[model samples]
Target: MKIVADLRDRFGVEPILRVLGVAPSTFYDWLAREAEPGERELLDRGLLTEIVDVHDRSGATYGSPRVHATLRRRGIRVGRKRIERLMRAHGLQGAFLRRGWRGGSTKQNPKATPAPDLVDRDFTAPGPNRLWVADATRIVCGDGVLWMAAVRDVFSNRIVGWKTSDRCNTDLVLGAW
Candidate 1:
């Protein structure tokens, strides 16, 4: 339809309509119709305003499901699918909160005695196996969370050893070495 309108002045309506596979009478009838919002369109506009208001009031944390529930609580009956559709159409989205490490200390262990800085932060080693750095990280897998520990040689910057286990403990790091 937009193609027909844009090319109508250039190529004239008949040729454009024929090429677009649209009848000329149908196009003319559509063009002559009143340019007013239909009942459903007006309702959607009003609903969109309400949806935006609800989304803002919730600090943009409420998705379509929660928004639908909130509307229902306020005596505005609407489907969850409709709310989802409207939110998507208007480019509205909910906040996504990521889960981070929560339980143990992520820093150096305070209970254990601190080791002396022998290298003084200089990672360069005289030869292979002379200076090795060890670290562990948690990986999320399909079964569950798995802990991985790796030992890297500073001379070659290569991983000399690695171990994966279900538990993150001294044993895991020792096994890596």
Candidate 2:
């Protein structure tokens, strides 16, 4: 629309519209919208103000879900998805609170000492055998779960060795090495 408005004076409206493949009615509608925003846009602006207010009232902790609930309780007819879109567009976010906490399956024992980061965040090695990283993970099969361990050479960026077992233990990792 801005392009058409700018070039219409030089090329004429119909020619510009023809080249741009925009219908005359569509161009006029865009002009009307620029003069006065559509109803939905006005509603969105008003709703954004209310959303900001609600977020402030909650110490900026109320996300779209909570804001939508509050607005509904106060007799406002609004959709949760619409509230979500507005909140997201305005960069409003809520603090993440996990509903349930379950420990990971591969958690290291507290008594065990963690392996030193020998690579120091650098994976590049001068030679193939100089740096070999190893990792192990559990995989589920048709019958049951299996543990897989792998050793990769940093220089070659290839798997040097790998092994799979029904049980995850030191033997499985050592077998890969």
Candidate 3:
């Protein structure tokens, strides 16, 4: 529309409007809108400014919901869908935690035999070392991830054996015991 306004003097209005596929009545209506802005247009324009500020302050991480919440906290009453519409029109978006689709991380070996459940869901033990349960966890370290494997004696309610390593696998668990 602005291009049509600027180049209309040089090339002419109808030619540019025809080339741009915009109706003459639509262009004239736009001119009238510029002359006297509608209430919704005025409100949307003001909201756009506030939305941009909130988005920028969040380092462009916040989406329409967060932006709307911030506006409401600051005593600005506006609908979330309206913020979404305005942000979409202006090409604004929140940062995504994950950019694209990814497959599951786990893969089981088809040929590997399953371990028998010796405990059979029962954890009670009358004496120490009669039964032990093990668990493994990974901790994010500065250099790398640390895998920790631990075994607990049910009777004593204490850790019987434990081990930590950079690599996590069956060997680490077996070695921990």
Query: What TM-score goes with each of the models?
Result: 0.42, 0.41, 0.56
Q: Tell me the tens digit of each residue's lDDT in model 1 across 1-177.
A: 766777888999998888878889888776765256678777888999999999999878899988999899888988889889999998998977568755553577779998898889998999998999999998966567899999999999999999999999999999999
lDDT of each: 0.87, 0.89, 0.90
The residue ranges of model 1 lying beyond 4 angstroms of the native Cα positions read 1-113
Q: Judging by lDDT, tell me the better candidate of 1 and 3.
A: 3
Off-target runs (Cα >4 Å) in candidate 3 are 99-177
lDDT of 3 by residue, 139-159 (tens): 866566899999999999999
Q: CA lDDT of 44 in candidate 1?
A: 85
Ranking the candidates on lDDT from highest down gives 3, 2, 1
Q: Can you rank all candidates by TM-score, best first?
A: 3, 1, 2
Best by lDDT: 3
Give the TM-score (vs. native) of candidate 1: 0.42
Candidate 2's TM-score: 0.41
By summed lDDT, the worst window of 10 consecutive residues in model 2 runs over: 97-106
